[model samples]
Target chain A: MNTELVLFGVFAVMTLVSAGLVITARSPINSAMALVSTFFFLAGIYVLLWAHTVAVMQVLVYAGAIMVLFLFVIMLLNLGEAAHRGRPTVTRILGGASAFGLLAVLAVTLGRTQALPAQMSAEVQGKFGTMAAIGESIFTTWLLPFEAVSLLLLVAMVGAVVVAKSRI
Target chain B: MVPITYYLLLAAALFCMGMFGVLVRTNALVVFMCVELMLNAVNLTFLAFARMHGALGGGPNAVFGVGHVSAFFVIAVAAAEAAIGLAIVIAVFRSRGSVNVDDIRTMKH
Candidate 1:
């Protein structure tokens, strides 16, 4: 068995299991913790895909920043006592059915694809996921989008402050 | 060598689970987390395609491609989304005294 494929399987299985926990855990805290682990494992998968920079950012942003925000909000809301795992309603049942249906279709479509060459020339691999390489592209070809995103983030920051401090 | 399809399939599964949570979960915070999951799923797809097509070089030193750049854009956008979304959740909780979505349907509140 190819070591890469084996590692991929391990990370993929772990990621799915963590994600399942994220949705099913009774406490929002538990779900947030599970989501953090899910992000960690997904970062592993991203590295396996030769996206080292993306993987690092995934860990830093998703696992570090995003999950912290999630935990903060969950605690601030004092939802620990509201751990009422409500009885599954009809909407939940339908949701599960549709989710499985969607997965089946995706499997069928993606499985039909032929195997792609997974080997990257050493030269390419060296340059492929490096921070410098990705950054170069971001500042050049994607310069406009990058600036727009910074502006968007600024707007979001201001908007969040205004909304969250409504009564203050 | 893992097949590219495996990555795509996993991303699809992740996206589907996120959709399910968004549809069925009543807690507004959990619903927002699900949205984050969906965004991550899309990011995975972008990186996978980026790897497959070798489209990520743009400088004289780097080859030219948009996949990695696209993933970066998605992450940036997701951060902004999370900020605004959580603020809304917080404001809603303060007004309604609960973060349950079912209790949040009225516009006049």
Candidate 2:
């Protein structure tokens, strides 16, 4: 088998297993930890797809920074008691059913779509998924979206601070 | 010995599973993790498309290049998103004394 297929298999198994643990694990903290591994495996899959930059960012941002913050909250909240109760409500059941419906739709779509396009050309491969190219696009073609995202993030930051500081 | 399709399908399955986790689990932290899984799913789609579009040189690179560049930008944005999202989650958890979605629904009225 080709290297791409082999690497993809490894990452795929890793992702699925970690994702399973994210749900099945009893401890909320353990679930968070399992998610970190899921992110790592996902990064591997990205690498196999030749998206080197995304893979690096996946490991650095999601697994590293995000998971750390999640752990911080879990620890600070000390949610052992609340987590044990496991919120069992009608809304949760409805939400779960909707999520399952979405899965069914996606499966049907995938099954119906055949004859996907093949891999990319040679010169593009030579470009080396560099930061420079990405920067250029972000500043040029995707400039508006980039700026909008920045503004959104700033607003989110301010909102977080305000919410956290509100009189309880 | 698996094919790339297998990987893609697996990613899709994991993504859906995570989505289910987000919807079913009332904990804000678990939902956040599920969102991360969704982002990872998009990352897989990006890479697959990048590979499928063929190399990044010649006319294609000069004209419509969606392979690696889009993927990289997406990852950066995902980072920023996670930072902001986690901060918000923290804020909400602090105010409500609980991260359970159902229990924290004061704004619904």
Candidate 3:
């Protein structure tokens, strides 16, 4: 077995398990911590996929910045232990059934797609995940979206401040 | 190399778990965390597709594929979403004194 496959397996398991904890943990702080681990594992998966830039951003943005925001909110709220609600209710049952249905559909669709070749060719692999290559595309053809994202960030920042301010 | 389907399946499972959390959890903050989980699942799909495209000779120089660019936008949007969403959560907690979704029914009153 190759090292790549082993790493993929390990990362995949870590990501999914941590994500499961993020949702199921009764304490929001615990859930936030789990989400942090989830982000880190996801960054590992991104590395395996050869999107090194995206992987770094995943760790920097999701694990570092976004999670800090989440923890801040959780602390600011001072949430107590969520009340121990009973097992699955009707809404939950329906929600789970539908989600599983969606999973089935996605599985079928994914199964149909051809698998990647056993080995990636050299030219295709080279420089694909580098920051330079990503920068080239982002500044060249994808410039408009790049600009738009900045605008979006500005609006989100202003809106967040306005909403979080105590006084209207 | 691992099959692309494995990544897709993993993403699907993560997405479903997130959905289950959103539906079942009463704590608004936990629900928000689930939403982030779902977004990460989507990011996995994007990276998987990007890898596939790159493997298919659609190199990083190819202008047609949107693998990395789409993932970039997704990450940016998710950041914005986390900021605004938490701000709203904080605002709600400030006004309601609690962040439980079931108890914060303003419209019914």
Candidate 4:
């Protein structure tokens, strides 16, 4: 068996299972912990996709920063085990059906793609998805968007503080 | 080498799970986590496509493909979204004393 395919299967299976746990865990803290594992597994999948920088970001920004934030909020809220973790509600049953339907549609649509992976030389593959390559692209081709995102982050920081505070 | 279709299918499955969580989960924070999962799925799709077509143009130079760049932007946006979303959740919990979606049905309370 191909090593890459094997690795992909492992990462993909782990990611989906953890994500399932994230949604199904009884407490919000359990869900948050499961989400962290899901992020870590997704980072593994990102590596398989040759996204080294993104994989690192997935671990750092997602598993590290964002998840910590989630944990802090969960603890602050002091949420306990869900009181109504009972039989599936009508809305939940409908949600599962629609989600499954969406999966089927997406599978059919992606199945029809006749395109194949573009072959790249060893050197190009090395350069592709690197921090340097992505940075160069962001600085030149996507400069405006990069700057806009920086601004958005700043605004979001201020907005979050303002909104989270008890009063104006 | 693994097929790009495999990655795409995995991403699609992940997206579906996230959608299901967002739709069915009642806890506001869990719903927010589901949104993050969906964003990550899209990022995976972007990288898979990048692997598929990153070297279309000028060989080595074309390594700076749109796919990676798009994923980078998505990650940044997701960070911003998380910050704002969590703040809103905290604010809502403070006011309502509960984070349950059913309890948070009113805007004025």
Cα-based lDDT at residue A104, candidate 1: 91
Highest DockQ scorer: 4
Q: Candidate 2: list runs displaced more than 4 Å.
A: A81-90, A115-119, A166-168, B1-4, B55-85
lDDT of 4 by residue, B1-109 (tens): 8888888999999999999999888889999999999999999999998888867765334346778888888988999999999999999888888888877656656
Candidate 1's docking class is medium
Model 2, span A35-102: residue lDDT tens: 98988888787766556776787788778877887888788778663446556678778877877787
> Candidate 4 chain A: minimum summed lDDT over ten consecutive residues — where?
A114-123
| DockQ per model, Cα | 0.63, 0.46, 0.65, 0.69
Comparison by lDDT, 1 against 2, better one? 1
Interface RMSD of structure candidate 2 (Å): 3.2
CA lDDT, candidate 3, residue A45 = 89
Q: Look at candidate 2 and give me any clashing residue pairs.
A: A120-B53, A120-B54, A120-B55, A121-B54, A121-B55, A123-B57, A124-B55, A124-B56, A124-B57, A125-B56
lDDT of each: 0.84, 0.69, 0.84, 0.88
For each candidate in turn, the TM-score is 0.93, 0.83, 0.92, 0.94
Tens digits of per-residue lDDT for model 3, A1-168: 999999989998998889888877879899999999999998898888888899999999989999899888877777768766636778778987888888889889888877672355675457677787788888888899899999999999999999999987
lDDT of 2 by residue, B1-109 (tens): 3334554566578778877887777677777778777777776776666565544353533524455656655665665666666667777776666777777766788
Report per-candidate TM-score of chain A alone.
0.92, 0.85, 0.91, 0.92
Using lDDT, rank the candidates from best to worst.
Answer: 4, 3, 1, 2
How many times do residue backbones clash in model 4? 0
C-alpha RMSD for every candidate? 2.3, 3.2, 2.2, 2.1
Model 4: what TM-score? 0.94
